[model samples]
Target: MPYVEVLAPQVPNQRKAALAKSVTDGLMTAFGVTADTVTLYFLPISPDDYAHAGEFEPQGAGQRILLKVHAFRRTEAERRAAAIALTRGVCSAYGVPGDDVAVYFLDRDRSEVAHDSKLASD
Candidate 1:
């Protein structure tokens, strides 16, 4: 299972849906998880609240999306492949520069999560 969180500027509902789907599809393909096992949260941050380097501009940050994926442990090779797939999916779905799509993975032990009210360690 994977829990995905996206931080970006405001987006239309349709675009948000596409963003979620794009990420979900990428993770599913790369990690072999089902749709039900993938959870996504899109957080809209004001441009004033976002800054890059020594500047702050709404559109500057708006043009990019930060993706964080939390999931069970995986080999380094798998992690790299998943990052590439995630970046490609975001770029393809949103017409953004590949660099604009940032991906970070937070790997956890199975004991750290649960599913269907059952602990993963169970």
Candidate 2:
């Protein structure tokens, strides 16, 4: 299972739907995983709640998205592909520059994950 958490500024529900679909498609292409195995959670942060360089509202600070991907370890190439996909999804959905998006891969083992109260390794 690959769980993706997206942290970004609030947007409309339609944009969220588009982002989810795009990201799921990318994950499938990059890791050869099925759509059912990919889960996405969006955490919207208000502009007032986000600060950069000690500035609550940084001028000219374009939209920034932080993506945390939790999944089993994969090759570096796979990770890179996933990152590209994620960035593309964010930029396309949010209309932000690619440079503003960041993807962080959090590698996990089967034993470290659970589904429906059952351990993945079981």
lDDT of 2 by residue, 30-116 (tens): 999999999999998776566666666644365568999999999999999999999999999999989889999999999999989
**Number of clashes in every candidate structure?**
0, 0
Flag regions of model 1 displaced more than 4 Å.
Answer: 58-63, 115-117
By summed lDDT, the worst window of 10 consecutive residues in model 1 runs over 55-64
lDDT of 1 by residue, 1-122 (tens): 79988887776888778877877877777888888888888887766776777677665654568888999987888788889887877776667888788888988898888878888989
Q: Each candidate's lDDT (Cα)?
A: 0.80, 0.90
TM-scores of all candidate predictions against the true structure: 0.84, 0.92
User: Per-residue lDDT for 84 in model 1?
Assistant: 88
Please report the candidate that would top lDDT against the real structure.
Answer: 2
Compared with the true structure, the alpha-carbon lDDT of candidate 2 equals 0.90
Residue pairs in collision within model 1: none
